[model samples]
Structures are given as C-alpha cells and as structure tokens.
Target: MNGTMPRSSLATTADVAVRRTVGSVTTPAPTTTPLRLPGVMDAEGRVDESRLRMHIFKNGGVSPTERGLVWRFLFGMYPCSSTALERPLLQEQLAVRYQVMKRKWQQMLPDSIRLRLNGTDAELVEAVRYFDQRQAHAQQQDQQEEVRDKLAFLELQAQVLFERVTFDLEELQEAIRIIDKDVPRTDRDLDYYLGEGSGNLLVLRNILITYAAFHPEVSYAQGMNDLCSRFLEVMDSEVDTFWSFSCYMEKFSKDFTADGLHRKIELEAALLKELDPQLYAHLVTDNMESFTFCHRWLLLGFQREFEHSDALRLFEILSCDHLELISQQVERARYQERLASKHSIVPEDNLLTEPQAINTDFTFELFICATILLENRESLLRCRNDVQLIQFTSSLQGTLDLNFTLKKAEEHFYNYCKRSAWDYMNGHCRTRKNKDEHFLYQLRSFFS
Candidate 1:
C-alpha cells in the first residue's frame, strides 16, 4: 500500500492530449517479466506488493502456480510487510484460531441433535459420559484434587460455550441450511468441483460454515459459496482457504447486505450516466435505472460471465485495485508538490485542505461494469425494456472477451485519472471529498 510509482510510469498530460489522435487510450504492453516466487519476495521475505499488483494489472495475470501465493498477498492473508519467517508463525497462529472457532460451532451439534431427536436427559448424559471416559483414561494417574480442578474447569468452559450457542443457534442453523443448499450447486460444472461428491465441495462448506458461525454480523449469504469456492480452489487447504476468504470478506462482506448492494448499484448507475448518458437515459425511460441485470455480475465478481479459468484471472485482477492505488499515489505526490510550492494558491475545497481518506471505493469494478455495457452499447440500446436487456445480458454468459474487456476497463481508468488531473489543475474540482465522485467527475469531463 505504501509504494511509489515514478512520475514517468503513469499516463501524462501529453498522453492525454494525444489520446484523441490515437482514437482511444491504450496502455503499453508490459515489458518486464511477470513476477514469480523468490523474485516477488525480497531477501528479507517481504513482498513488493505494489509492484506485484502493477504487474498483474499490466500483464493480465500470473501463472496458476504463482496465483495462489499472489492472491495470499492481495487478499491480505499475509501482510505485504511480513517476512517469510513471520508467515509460518502467522499461519500456525491462524490455524489454531480457526480450529478454536470451528469447535465452537461443532460443540453445539450434540445439543442440536438432542433437541431434534427429543432425546431424554439420560441419553444426553450417556453421550457426555463417553467423552469423559476418554479424558479419564488420559489422566488416570492424576491426584484426586487435580482431577476435580480439571472437572471444574471443564464445567466453566462448557457454560461459556453454552451461552454463545444459545445466543447464536437460531441464526447459525438458518445459515447452515442455506449453505448446504448452495454448496453443491456452486460451480459444479468445473472439473475441480464437478462431481456430486467432490471433497472440495466439503471444504467449501466448512469454510462458509466457519465464517458464518463467527461473523454473525454478516453471516452466510447465498453468493458467499461462490466466493469461498474460488479461494478453496486456489488455496486448496481448508485452513488456508478459510483464513484467506475471511480476509477478503473483511472488505466485501457488506456487499451481501441490502443497503450495501443498493449503494453499489447506485454508483454503477451514476457511472453509466457519465460514461454513456444516452444509454443511461434509455434505462431511466424504461424504469430500469436499478440496473438489477448486472447484480449477479457484481455480487459474484463476474463469476458467471466468463469461463471458469478466466473468471479466476479476473477476480485476482479486480482484487489488485491497481488503478485506484496508482491514483492515490498520484494524488499524494500532487498534494506534496502543492504544499512545497511557495506561490501555490490552495483551493477552499475540502479535497485540498483535508487529509486524503484511504481509497476503498473499489471503483475499478464499476468501471469494468461500464466497460461491459459500453462494449454492448448498440445491442443494449436496441432493447426496448428491462426484460430484453436482462435476457441479452444473461445470454452473454461465458461469452464476453476477457482480454478485450480488461484492456478497455484499464483505458477507462487511465482516462478517468487524466480527466481528474485536468479538472484539479483547472480549479474545477468540487468541494466534496469522495474519490468515487472524482472518478465520475473525470468520466463526465472525458465524455464532454
């Protein structure tokens, strides 16, 4: 997150001026070799994450062998600053924590079964006695007092676990029910998850259950099975997949909520208005401004729109947030330059006066959505209503061109940056303090 891009690395004013002559914004194809292990890692074992992200952005993606490790960094399973020595220790810690959380939910199952089967107290006691016998066998030589102390400790621990289960049981049961239904249905056509009895499907279920059990605030959602499947496919290990999926959910868990999804849809509509006003107007006329047709695309990270492998590639690309990161660095450098210049006139706008907020808007995803729409602008325009629009978009399943769409999205992002720089230079920047608005502002100026 804290890396510098040489000024020459990004598109410049001259490039923007020449954009018209060139017909469209075009990024130079990456010349450096794609980063691999050992090279991506320094002698100290710290990853140059910014460089890795930029490489993915420029080169499309990494080899499958490289992707698992790269995604570990991108999704924050391992910090960019953590050394190789620290990661093993960190993994051990996470593994222990994961097991502890997993047991919390698992321990409730006996009680759950008792309730479901209407078992008598005597039967429940028999079940508890079986586990106690194992503990007694392990501690046969312990003094009577020591054994009593251990029993007391166990009683206290059970009380705590009981309280947690009592509070969360209803919600957790509902989450598990939904997850059971969704897991088998998620990406079953793919070779990795193809069979009804795929072990990977079980791994996917455990990760989602663990996530739901612990994160009650955002508990299991329908789309999470798809998201977790992607991580499990790459990471493979159950512990690793759970931790990585949790890290990713830290940022995106809100997307599963009604409010969060509405906000994203609104942002997409606002962006479409800027990028293609005529199309936006047509949707509005047809009362389709909600843009619900693309809801699955956004929710699942376009998992259904592209072929399986390409969708995996696209997920990592979106995770990198390279454009937003670069724009943040550029803004920081410009802010510094302005402060250093004695003759500089600071604007009254909050954008100039206040400290810049961390950029978490994930605008690149919206830009990619806009790129998809604009790519099909003619076809979309020909549709007279929302039903036709949804049908046309649905028919594009596994048919969109990944490379072409990605390149166009990158261009749109670069053009957005250039246009924002132009607006800021001309004293036209609004007093508002959101980075997403800046993206929309730039698109407005670019189209104008």
Candidate 2:
C-alpha cells in the first residue's frame, strides 16, 4: 500500500496566517468555449438520456473539450436533462453558496486561534484531559486563596482555549495546513502542477481546502487530493470543479473516513470470498486483511494504476453507469442481422462483444479489483504466507495496463452476469424485457 500522509499534523502559526490572508475566491476566466456532445444533446442543448448513455457506454470517453460538461452530468452536479442555458445559472447559484461556506472559516481565523490549531487530534484530546484533571484539583484546593486565584486564571485560559478549538476555523486551519504540504506533492511529474505561482496546482489545493470548509465532517482525507486532481483536470471553473468534486465525495466519502475505511476493507474481503473463493481462502490462510492491499485500489479508484488520461477516461466511464446499455446495443445489432438472414451466423467471439470499453459503477470497480487479484492469482496462491502476498500486491503501483485491466474487468462482469443466468435473448438485462423483439421482427419481414 502507498504510504498516506496523515491529516492530523499541526501547522506553524505563519502557515495559518498565510492561508487566512487570501479570504476571497478569484473565479478563473473561461479560456475556451465549452464543447457540446453532438448526438447526446438536441438543438436546444437538452440531453438525450438514452443516446448519451449509449454513446458513453460504447465510446468509453468524450473528447477533452467535452469532458467537463459530460462529467457534470455524470457526477449529477448538473442534471442530464437540463438545457445548456440552465447550467450557467445553476453554476452561479452554487458559486455564491460555495463562497458563503468558505468565508465562515476565513472570518474566524486569528493569531490566537492559529496557535490553538497547531496540535494533532491526539494532542488536542490530551489537552482536554489535562484541563479536566486540573479543574478537579482546583476544586480540592478551594480553601487556599493563592492557589485558588491561580486556578481561576488557569480555568479562564482553558475556557478560552477550548472556545478557539471549537470554532470551525480551527479545523479548517488544520486541514489547509495539511493540504499545503500535500498539494506540491500531487502529480509533480505532470506538467500541470509544475509551474510556480497560482498554477493549476494551487487551484487543486484551493478546491480541497474549500471542500474541507464546506463538508467539515469529512474535513479532509489524505487520498482526497488524488480524487480532486482528476476533477480539476476535467472541470475548468473552480466553482464547477469544487461542486463536482463534492458530488463525487457524496458517494465515496465513506471509503475515506475512519470507520468507513475498515468497513470497505472488510466489504472487499467478503466480496473476494464470494467472487473468487480460492483466492479468498489463500488470503485468509495467510492471515492478511483484504485491506492490507485493497486500500489503495478503493481509495483512489485505481488512479495510480494507469496513465493520467486513462485514469480520467476510466473515471468518466465509471461515473456514467452506461455499460449495460452498450451490451444491449451490441446484442441488438447482432440480433437484427441474424433476423435479416436465416443462416447469418454471429461469431462466438465477435469484436463488438469484447469488453473494450468499461462502465464503472462502484460495484464494477469491485469487479476490476477482482480482475487484478485474479491476474495476479497464480503468484498469490504460490505465496507461503501473508508476507510474500503483501509484497506482490503493494508492488503493483505503476505497472498495470489500464486497457488490459479494464478488458479483464469487463470479462469478469460478463461472466458474473452469465453465472447468474443473465438473459441475453432478452433486451433489458435488469428487467428481463424483450425490447428489441419488434426490431428483430421488422428485419425478418423486410428480408422475406
């Protein structure tokens, strides 16, 4: 597993002051015209849900120009059915709300508050414990005047200290400090974050800090920067970028939280046990928690496993939930040809039926994880125990092929669908309806 920098570290007073100095957001000017998806949007710029779904499912990704707009729909930040005219107004409204949320912490931060923010969570907890003990001792010394005056002074200071700590600004300060350290470390190899002042790298950090202020509950998680980097790459406007990232977090925050991380690890373990019993048994026999390796996979959604653009493509496809649509389109085309000629033979291994493109429901990602494990299954099973298994899994950081991995993921998904007796002759996989039967009949009649 990749080492995670903890969010609990304290920052210096100067660092907190620097963050507080920039209180307002500077909206980045639009640099290029937003590209529209052709068939997916009508003349009025309203989305065609079925067409959009099928296009993304079949194509895997949109052009770079069209990606931000497409992702807004995928993330549910902008409604798929919404018109282009409606989006700007919606974004304006969100941007106002976003600024309001961000300003709360900005207004409250001060030098005394900055000093109070410079403690880890454990340190803060211990501070509170010591205060309570001193208070208790103060009660016992009530008969001594000199000690009582000093105790009163100490009690007043403690009350002020706790008051500062209770402000949302304090948490925001801590999160910003952590983000400052982590931002420069983000994707440094890429040209995007390389420049010196107010670059996209700074924008990425701003998004994270702004998000921490807004959610406050999941203030900041370590791996969130990876998720935000992908969002920034797609969405140009900071407001759009921030909201879209928030929308992404809505579904995934649990995977990053304290309790939720463990639960997901266990969930993956149980899923592996069900999907590939042999691999699961080998893992348990070695006494390795599924999370020992699966943590990074789930945390960043295999972002590190592939190239940057490939990761973006994978994320957009996964967000759209259109894989089943593509499968139906392929089957429908094959069925029509078959109906047109009585002897028309569909190849057992048709090119269109292969899992060339992948749709990523979180469940679909689990399948991808399964595929990765199975890809490495032989080596894993050969391991004497957990040590060698962990070694193999951890070393898979930068070596996997996104395309091959996705193809295998799709195969796993299809086979799982098959094992459950997935209806192929039927049009709707989920509902088991023959939606294409009418088209099949028309083709047959025309040929006759």
Candidate 3:
C-alpha cells in the first residue's frame, strides 16, 4: 500500500470538498455535499493525483461519481496539476479546436455536391484547381478541338468529383453502419445504454464517427464502440467525450492496429515466459499462444475482466506515471524547506513519500497478463491439451478481482524490474536495434 488513509469517514459531511471554480468565478460550498470517494479529490475539485493513484492501486477503484473526472486525467485530456479554474478555459479551447477539425472534414464536399444538398462548402480549391488546369491546357489546343475537349473534360471532372465524394461518403457510411451495429450491443445490460431513441447512444455514435473522421487510417474498429462507451458515459458533454476519446486513442490506438496487436502479443508471451517459466512451458506444450487468450485483454485493458467501475479504477492507477514531475517538485520543496531551516534535517514523513518506483514503461498490462496466467497456473497445468488450456483462459472474463489482480501484478512487475537490473548489469540482455533502444539504455543507466 502507498500509505494508510486518514481514519475519519464522512456520513452527512462531504467525502471531499472541492471549491467549484469556473473561469474567474468561485462558487460557494454546497449546503449538502454529495457522497464521493473519500480523499481522492481536494477541496478545489482537482484530483490529488498521486494520492488518488495510490488509493486506487490499493483499493481497486473509486466511486462512480469520481471516475469521470479521474479518468479525464488518466486519459491525458486533463493534466494532473491543472487547477479547477483552468479546466473551463482548456475545455473551451478544445471545443473550438474540435469544431475546426470536424468542420474541415465536413467541408471536404465539392461546391456542386454541397449546393445540391444546400450545404455550404468552405474548401473549393479542388474544383477551382480543376477549372484552372483545364483553362491552361485549353490554350494549347485548337479552338474547335478545345470546345469538344472542354465538354469531355467537364464530364470527366464531374465524374472524378462525384467519385471522390462518393468514396468519402461511402467511408463515412461504412463507419456509421459499423458503429450502428456495435452501438446497440454496447453494454446493453446497463440502463444507461438501454431504451430506444437514447441521446447517449447518439453521443456515442457521434464520438466514434468523429474519431473515424479524424483518424481515417484505422477507421472504426469493432472494439472502438466499446472503448467510446466509457468516455461518453464518463463525460456528459458530446464535445468533451470526443476530445477525451481522441486523447485516449493516442495510447490505445496501437491496440487497434495489426502491428500493435502483434507487438503486444509478443510482449505478453515474453513477459509471461519470464515471469512464470512453468506456465509458459505448459502453454507452449499445449500450443496455446498468448494471442489466443490475451488479445482481448490488451485491446480493452482488461475492461472485460472486471466490473465497469472496477475497470475504470484499474485503468486510472495503471495510467498514473507516478507523477515524476510531482516527485521532483517534492524534492525541490524539501530542499528549500531545509535551506530555510538553517540546514536542519527536513522530515520525510509526508504522505506522498515515494516507495517502490514502479517501472512506468507501459508494461503494467503485461504484468497483469502474467498474474492472470500465474493465478490459474494449477488449473492450466491440469489441462490435458490446447483446447482445454484455451477454454480455461478464455473463461477468465468477468471473474477477476481488480484489487487482487493489481496487487499480484505489482509484485510480478517488481520482480521483473529486479531481473531487468540483473540482466543489464551482467550484459545478459539482448541488444536490440530499434526506437526503444534509448529507453532501454536509460533504464540501464538508472540501474547502473
């Protein structure tokens, strides 16, 4: 555990008192503060991120009301150190920027197509360029031939424009159709997703579509709908959901890619092999590869394993970078306080005291995968064949305790860190030529 929490608990009083400030205005405290997760947030409504992270690490997850704002920081949509007052300004700026991007795609239609639909087109350079090229080329041809050629060229240009617009529209329609297929199936058991003509469903669809438009490269993967559902639920506003989802995709979009999946699958197998050699051998003997059972875990970050609320908490703790800058801030403040005290010893008994430095190397999920496989090691070892092993691991869905899993995963990760240090010190680790070499070198340097 990071540190034990304060003993006092709230009954009628607020669990956390955050001063509600918007822009330059500060709202007075409510007569009745709503029940919230104890100590995760401050009186200013800003997250005490380091404490919140450790709390979630020890306790599994936060209350439902706190998950929304907590997830914003986790998703990098909001900085951990940002004040409540700055949030309004930042959100307003992102809202404007989102509009600009959405409008950029919306205005991709040609004037002819836009005029027919009575939708104004702000981007007309393509059509203008086509006419300009035609005029320039026409000057070189015979007058009679040019007239005939102009008609043919106009027809061809119209066809090209129609085809281009048709392709774009087709892509959009496909994305919508895919989203439509998945939206109805998204957490339908929950009352929030149920009911016909739900506005939340519309918001979910729009966020996915907007993401598809922004990232045309990986347009609307199957699991993307499930991913967007959390964001939409957490953030009530459509604009906020869109931007938050976009920010989340920065790290998560890798899972949606073929190469990304392969990398994760490889990493999972390697980590598990290192963490539990016996389990690895059993899996290999049974012909059960990590990809067979671990793909979903990587793609969704174990969202399928735990309950919705628990999964949210697990993600927040996993997303925490241990606040390195905050650690530095603490160090600087300590130095200054000691200096002010005439070189007297400064107390190191603060709640934010650094304990085990977690290797925030994006391998926490790998550790979780290792823990899952290790948890079922006996059952896995009992399996007679690949089918049995695959079936057993496949059945892990919805049966995991987020708190236990995290605790076990952290243990495994600390072991990995030790092994990593040993291997680097002994020059037993592989020397890879890639983008990650620098990171490995840095880790080695830290250890050395």
Candidate 4:
C-alpha cells in the first residue's frame, strides 16, 4: 500500500474519521536502513522539538519515507486539523507537525483502534501529543529502495568481514549462557527500565514497559523477558529486538488478552478434538476438560513448557517467520465465530462486521504455538499424570523441526482458508465501532 493517498489525498477505507490506530501502525516490508532508535521517549523528559531529530534519535535512524513524514509534519506541509491535531502547545509549524503525525498514523486504520489508543473521553490534543512522540524513539527506518540496496550491500560486506575474522563461538556461547542466566526475570514487575537499552535484558524490559499501556492485562509476563532476551541475542540491536518482538506479539495476542485466553484454550482444545478426538476423550477422562495447565504454555509461550534454551530457540525460529503453523490455524476463526454467538458481535455499516471472520494473518501466532504443541503431540498423548505432562512438554525443548513445522502450519492455514471465507483477523479492524454501533442501535429501543 502506497503511503500516498490518491484523489482526495486521504485514504477512504473508513480508516479516516479516527479509524487509524496506533497498533495498526505496522512496519511494512523490508526497505532501506536509515536509522532507528530503541523505543520512544523514556520516563525522563528528553524530547526536543523537530520530530525529524526525535525519530532519528529514537529509532536510531529513520527510513526515507518515515523521515519524510517526520519532516513534512514538523514544517507544516501537512495539517492535522482538529481530528488529527492533539493540541497547540507550539506555534503553527510545530503544532501542525504534531497534527500531521497523528493524522498520518490515524489514517488507513479503524476508528475502534484509535479509540483504544485514546481510551474514552481523553482530549484529542492530549492523545495526539502522546502519540506524537510515543514512537518518536521507536520509529523504524524504511528508506527508499536505493538506500535499502546500499545498506544490504554494506551488511553483506560486514558479513564477509565477520566470516573473515577469527570469531569465538565458545566465548559467545559462554556469554549467552551467563547473560541468560544472570538477567533478572523479575523485571516483569517494573514499569520501565531507567537504564535504557543497556543490553538485551534491559531492552526487553523497555519494550515490555513501552507496550504495557497498549496491552494492560499482559503487563509484563515473566517469559516475555526471556523472549526479548532471545530477540536481542539474535537481532543484536535493541530496536530490532523490539520490532521483532512486536511482530511476534501480533500472533501471540490471544494468549495475553484477559478472558480471551479461555477462548484460546477452548479453541486449542477444539482443534485437538478435531485432529485427535481420541486424545480429547483421554484428556476428558483425566478431568482435564477445561484445559487449564495448557494456559501457562499458551500464555508464556512454552517458556514454562520447555527449557529456557529450547524455548529461546523455538521462539527465535518462530519469530523468523519460517513455520507452517503460521498459516494453518482454524482455532482463531472458530473462536471468532464463537464470539458472535454471545451477541457481543456487531454489524457495522460499510465495514464487514455483519458476519465476522478471522484474518489469516492472525493465525501466525497460533500457528507457532500450535506447531510447538503439535510437534510434541505424540509424546503429549502418552503422558498420564500432570507432572509427566509438564515434563513431556518440557522435554520438547530443542528438538523442534522449524522448517517442517512452519510448512505444515502453512499448508493447514492455506487449505483451511480455502475451505473458509473472508479474512478472519483483518475483518474486525474496527471492532470497537462495531460494538458501539450495535449498542447505540440497542438504545433506539427507548424511542420504540
């Protein structure tokens, strides 16, 4: 999708009108490497004017396009209007920049997403101001094609140099061991790490804190520290670590949502029932009809289900987008259909909420989680006692066949999608609006 809108200069996909959400502000495909900062503003008051500079510093650097937005907004080429403009703390030029920033972000997204970002009854200025710099630091750089080519070249050159050097695997391995072991897992309870991008552990903590507001219930789960650490361990840069983790969370969202987790468990159980009804019956015989223990597995993402090192490896592989489970999930759609039955589901004008469907992309996280469990299903089936079950899942640590698992999941996803209809996940982009519209319609009963 081109960032530039045609005709009226504004995207008309119903994403306008407070529809564009912060969460939907996704990093497009790989592009040039300009500069990127870790996460946005810290607990301290360190942001200066000129969004260009702020984003460049925050994200470590900016992509040409993002940089263009930064500069355009800052200089006043783009006006945010009341809808986009958060406030008028600065002169028109600066105020417009803030406006353009929120307006651009709010564009092409659902109104419900915007509401979630602003919450209820908060002034537009206050909300816009918050978003203006929230990602000022985390802004990922997706420069033009030429820049990307050059950056790729340099990376290749660096890779060659790395190969030429006498690298120490054992030493690096030792470092990983020590770092993974030493980092305090308790950082989950902390709101933010004042230390800032000091290392993988701290970087992980920072991302968690930054997103805590977006996902309040998930807050800071223990295993997330491990996930962040592994991402940094592989990505090397804190920015990359956060981006990768954020991407990972896209799929793993169900595990974190309150009350929804039970739905996840039910879906997982349903899939298992479909695939192996015999096993479902077996579990039911054991008083495991509720699928409780598996909650931690889905929630922490196998951190408790497997060894630390193994969990790290599995997550890293899943994060790489190289698994089949990513495509082959029926549970999400099944669950969405279930949600509709509760009457909480709504129909929206223009949007496709009349009958909700799961987005195929939503399957990505479920695929990873499913792949992890499906790979160990053979062993999982044999276990009788809870300890043995945990032990058996834990045993599936490092032996996961990454490629095979992803391929299988993809095969399942593609096939299932063909059998199903509509994009399940993306369809509900304006979920809040759907709910609101439905509620308001209900209120008209007073007139009746």
Candidate 5:
C-alpha cells in the first residue's frame, strides 16, 4: 500500500460549485468543428488555484455543453439530476448545442452500431452483441432522430466501458473481427459489443496528484485498477463516473501515500496512550506497543479484509453520511483498556499475561483483530517485541457483526463517553480521545 497513491478526486469540488452556477451559465466560443466530446477537459473554466483551493466548492457553474457534459460525469448512473436543476442555463441555446454533441458521438462510432442507438432498449441491445449471446441484426432508415442520436452516444459509452478482453489463438481472425466490429455498412445495425476508446490519461494523472493533495510525501503511481474498474461500473457517463470516483477516493487519499504517511496510525497510537496509562506503560516497558495491523483494513477500505458483497454495503453505508463511529469507538476503547491493563500486571509477570478488556465495534464486527491481539498478548508482554506487535496487528481478516461489535463496545464505555450510539452520532463531539483515554485510565482502578 505504501507505493499506491490515492486516485483522482478533482471533480468533487467542481460539481458543488458548478451546481450553483448552472443557473448563470455563459455560452462558449462558437466553432464549426466538433469540439472534443468525450475527452477529459476541465468542464469548469479556470480558477486562481491558490485562492480557490478550499472554496472551489462555492464557485460559479456550468456552460450549456458543460452541464450536459458534467451531468454525465457527476451522476453517470445515479438518477439524472432534473433538468429543472439547470433551468437557468439558457435552455433554448443549450438544446441546440446538445444536438451537436449527438453528432460528434455518431462520427466516432461505426454505422451499424450507430443505427442501433436510435431504437428502444431491446432494439439497442439487438444491434449490439451481449457478453454471452448472439442475435440477428436489423435494418434502419438514413435519417437521424434526436432520441436515437442521444441513445447512440450512450450505447457507444456502454460498449467502451463494459467490453471485455477476448482470448483467441488466431491473431488474423481477431484482427479482422476487430475491424469488422468497428466499421458499419448499409442499413445493418452494428454490434454494440464494445470496442476501445482513447484513455483519458490527463484525467487519470490529475486523479493521482489531486488524490494525494494532503500528503506530498506520497508519489502518484498506477495500479489503481480496482478503483477505476468500480468507478466505470457505477458510472456509465464518463464525466460523472470520473467525478464520483473522485469523491469516493477522498477518505483513502492519505493511506495511499508513501511510507511516511502515519497520521492516522500515529493518532491511533496516541489515542491508546491517552486511554490507558498502565497498559501504555506495560507496552512501553515490554517494547510491545502500537497498533498497525488496522492499517490495510482501513486503507484499502478493508477490501481484502471482508467478503465481496459486504464491501459494497460498507461503501454504501459510508456514502450515506459523515459517520465514522467505528474508528472513533475503537480509538476510545484502545485508550481506556491501556489504563486498566497497566495495574493488572504482577511485577514478575510479563505484560501479555495481563488483559486489557477491549470495548470496540472492531472487537465484534471485526472481532477477529481483537482475537488475534488477545491470542498474541501473552508473548507480546513476555518478549516486549515492538516489531512483532506491529506484525501481529496487521494480520487480521474475515467478515463480522459490525453493529453487534459496536453495541459490545458501547458497553465498555460505562465510565467514559457513555452516550448511546444515536446520541454520540447526533451531537457528541468530545474528540474520541477523551472518552477513550478515560476508559483505559479507569481500567487500572477497576482491577487494582
């Protein structure tokens, strides 16, 4: 994870700003030639980078072409924002411009495939090959309808993003297939099965640097295939998908940085210190301290840590609000238990022999991590090995009862930030450290 930087998130601030300005959009320089439709460009015009850094969210909005363009980028698959949202975009002129966009997409696609874009969903699919099935083709008139034009553009988009790579031994046959697939002839509808499009390298590069904005320590590298793939899956419209993916990457930017990125882990360890002085002391005395295992679990958004379906649910839930209760709760518990466990140790006994009761959602939802810690605690205290402690924390996996774990964690907060989950989420803002540190600090007294 050290080599991987966060992907692009450039459009998030722009989307908010653009939304405000859609009402007051200005017309662009008129040109006879088709402007690049699908290529990545700053849909929003320039801003003073230094001054607009934070308030990019409040800037003015889109052009007629820009709205049509941004609409696809921001919402791609989410329901199209109501046209009413763009009521002030001088609708009459914009409609004419959008028609030009339709023509541009047609020019890029093959004739057969282009024809299919005019029909209904079934007709559209029929014009193109599906992943597993083959069907007969159909006929089309020469005249272009507005609906078909827009539909053609969307179909072309679907083909580019959804097309899968093929593996056939005959190189010549594959090449012929590729050429035939691209060129359309006569009245026949072309296969909508996708072909390739030019990679938006600029947008991708921007994604990397912009994602790593906070931590200049990290380099913007590649191999973010999974994130990009998922982005395409959710967003068919190129611009919308790109922007939404940017928003999704915000929480992960820091972790994607270089080895020096330790703000979260450092904070986690700090929370531990504030929580339980005794455990903290024992960990220090034994050279067994710091919680680093949770790094990957947190960094990759726990991709490898949980099952497939569960990952989606996690993303969906995270997207639902600004809630980060689990992280906060775990920090609190780790801190509190540190205090309790410190006093439990006999002078002659190793620190591992003393248990710091963990009250955290992670104990249950991701209870596996806690179990691993507990299993290794005895040895950790005996050897007081810091490196081993780091390794042990990093190895946990498996799906879990997140809500139950949270409930269980709440039970341990009896003397700390004891607010119910609902209350804590709604208004509680003691900075998880206080509640967590208090909990751990009391552990010593509880067992003393």
Candidate 6:
C-alpha cells in the first residue's frame, strides 16, 4: 500500500496469459522458472540477487540440486554483489574465522577432555604415553611422599580450575550439553541424521555449540537445533553452514527473545483482527488472545507444519521477503518523485535509490499465518478454548497444501493493500501505535 502497484496491477502480460479460478475468485496463474546454475550467476559469477529472490518467490523454490548455492546467496554466505574472483578469498577468510571461534570454545576444556573429544588416535595415544612414563618414573624414584604430595597438588589444581572457570564458560558448557542432547533427535527420520554416528549430527552439534560460544547473548535455545540442522542439510560445508546460519539469525535471532516474540504475537493478533474481526473476537472470548500456539510456527518458520523438503522451500521463500521488497521499492520511488516535483527537476529514468532496510513489522510471513487461520476459520471458530485450538493447529502438521496456501497468502496481501488504499482515500484511516498506524500513514502518503 506504500504507493506500490497493487498485485493485480503489477501482474505482467505473461502472468495474465494463464489464469486460474477458485471459488469465483480469479487470480494470476502460478508459474515456476526457478533459477538454475548459470542463471543465478552473472558472467562474473556474482549473484543476481533480485532475480534469484523473485524466482524463488514466483517459482515456489529452486530445485534440490541448486538449493545449496542459492541459499548461500540468500543467507549472506556469498554477497550478491561479490564477484567470482573475490569469493574464494572471502570463503577462506570466513573459514579461518569459523575455525578461530570453534577453537575458542574447544580450548576452554581441560587438555585431557579436549583431546578425547577432538583429538586424533595418535594424539590420544601420545597423551597416554606421556602420563604412563611420568607414573613409571615416579615409581622408580621411590618417592612415595613426593607422589602423594603431587596427587594432592593435582587435585588442588583441578579445584582451582573449576573455581576459576568464568560464569560465561559454565553457561556455554550447559548450552553445549543441551545441544548434544537435542542434535541426535533433530531430523532423525531423514537419512542425513538417521543414526547416532551420523557425521551430519556431529556438524550440527559443532555449529550450535560454536554459535552458543560466540553469541552468549542468545546462546543455544531449544528450537535452534531444528533451525541449524536445516542449514546443515543444504550447505554441507561446516564453515559455510555456520556462517549462513549466523547470517539468518541476524534477522530472526530476535524471535528467540521474550520482548521480540511478544511484539510478533501482538502484530499477528493485530493482523488477524484487521483481517477478520469476528474471528479475533471469538478468540478473545475463549482466552486465546495470546496466540501461544503460533510460537512454534513463527519460531521455526513453520518448519514443522510441512514435510522436510517443503519446509525448506517455505523457508527460502519467506527469507526472500519478495512482496515486502516490492513495497519498499514503491515507497522509495514515491519519495524520489516527490523530491523531483518539489525541486522542479526531471528524474532520470535509470537512477537508483539507496537500498532500504526491510521493515519486519509487516512481513509476508504474517500474511501466511493469517491465510492459514482463514483457511480453517470454521474449525477454529468451533474451538472454545486454548487447548482445543492448540490441538487443532497441531493436527495440521505436515498436512498443509503449500502451493494453495502460498497463492491464498499472496491474494490476502493484495487485498490488504487495496483495502488500505481505499481506506486512506476515503479519509477513514487513523493512526495508532500498536495497530498499524504507521502503515496507515504510509498509505495516506502514498495516495497523496
């Protein structure tokens, strides 16, 4: 609604060439031309990010073979603007950084423990030989009293080491413990994570622990294992997976915090109220206002709602935020137009404005959530309490129609924009901080 062309208006001739009708509503025909190998890369081997993102959104997702390289761009492992010549250097730098951080946590353990966990057979054998030789020497010297004193000193050394361990280190160790327990259970049904000895599982544990070590602020959380495992599956390299996961967390890390999560819930609730007042009212009456069931959905990006492959597709699509990017571009264009008009200047046709940060407040993910609710409006309406609502949502796991849901969500977004424009033109829009007042302002300005 920020002066952007409505979805219907933005549709191209090709989009309209094939139409689909659903229950009296006709929409653009779905088309897919996912970017493949050379298509994603320019002559210089730099990514065409805008094109890649659009392809993912329009085509649903890239093919399984291309997902890894495509995700590298999407998650910031390779910057869209970086050339092939620059990428290898960048990869080396990142790999070094990953190892440095990995070692930082690894070195925190006592030598024996560290060697046992990360050492090779030769190193472990050398450690054993060193200890045995020292014990033999002590026995041959017949220094019974000295040996007893040495044992006491060793015990005291351990006690001091324990006492000297930083609070942060203890916290990290606890996070590692939890991550160890969770890694085995993550995506276990998949062949990649099928066994206790799965190398993929080890990689998953390392990334999570390293993430925890570096990001003490939002150290390992319960659901992070699910998130990390997905990245590991796509990006087989340990360093690439860690960095890509870290980049992803930059945007979504807030989702793991209390206030950030509460704000999202409020926004979701506001959206539902705007989209369907009756449904919101019914939920309020049933003391389901918290929308707690949505926690997992938002936290894991609805990873559990669909099968593994579909969830990957959904994550990449959501990460694209294609609609939101379009909205931002529209807003920027309007701003440029206003300046041109004020200064009596002619705007250049090819001038580009600086990129704007994405507004997370009104992301397309919320629309997807709204679409799911409206799709099941009748069933949700019948539920009178939170438990029933939770059960109903839980039962929806792995049963969603991804294509249908995406199409419907897109429709909802277009409709919302149209409604916002209409409300602004009619002078009925009001601004309130918690209730999309800023968005209404943008709408009014866009129309003005």
Evaluate model 2: give its TM-score. Answer: 0.65
Q: Rank order by lDDT, top first?
A: 6, 1, 2, 3, 4, 5
- The residue-by-residue lDDT of candidate 3 on 141-248, one tens digit each, is 433544345334433432333233222556765776677668656776666654432435545655676577656666689998887887777665566677678777
Ranking by TM-score: 1, 6, 2, 3, 4, 5
Cα-based lDDT for every prediction: 0.65, 0.59, 0.56, 0.41, 0.34, 0.65
Question: lDDT at 216 for candidate 2?
Answer: 68
User: Best lDDT goes to which candidate?
Assistant: 6
Residue by residue across 366-417, what tens digits does model 5's lDDT show? 3323323334456555545777665544443444443443233333333323
Expressed as tens digits, the lDDT of each residue in 176-235 for candidate 4 is 333333344433322232233222233343345433322333434445666565545543
TM-score of each: 0.70, 0.65, 0.61, 0.38, 0.37, 0.69
Angstrom error of the Cα, residue 385, model 5: value is 4.0
State the displacement of the C-alpha of residue 389, model 4, in Å, after optimal TM-score superposition.
Answer: 1.2
| lDDT of the structure predicted as candidate 6 | 0.65
| Regions more than 4 Å wrong, model 4 | 1-183, 186-199, 210-218, 239-254, 300-378, 410-448
Please provide, for model 2 over 1-448, each residue's C-alpha lDDT reduced to its tens digit, 9 standing for 90 to 100.
Answer: 0111122211101100010101234333222243465677676566777666556655767778778777776776676665555554455445544554444444555332222322453433343444445435534532355533543443343234333233465676788778866765677666554433225665576578767765666789788887888787677556778877877787778888768778767667766775789878878763665446777877788887777777787777676665455445445664554454345343444313322222223266677788888898898888775677778877887788877887777766655544332233322222314454433332223212
Global local distance difference test of model 5: 0.34
State which candidate, 1 or 4, has the greater lDDT. Answer: 1
User: Highest TM-score, which number?
Assistant: 1
What's the C-alpha lDDT at position 273 in model 6?
88
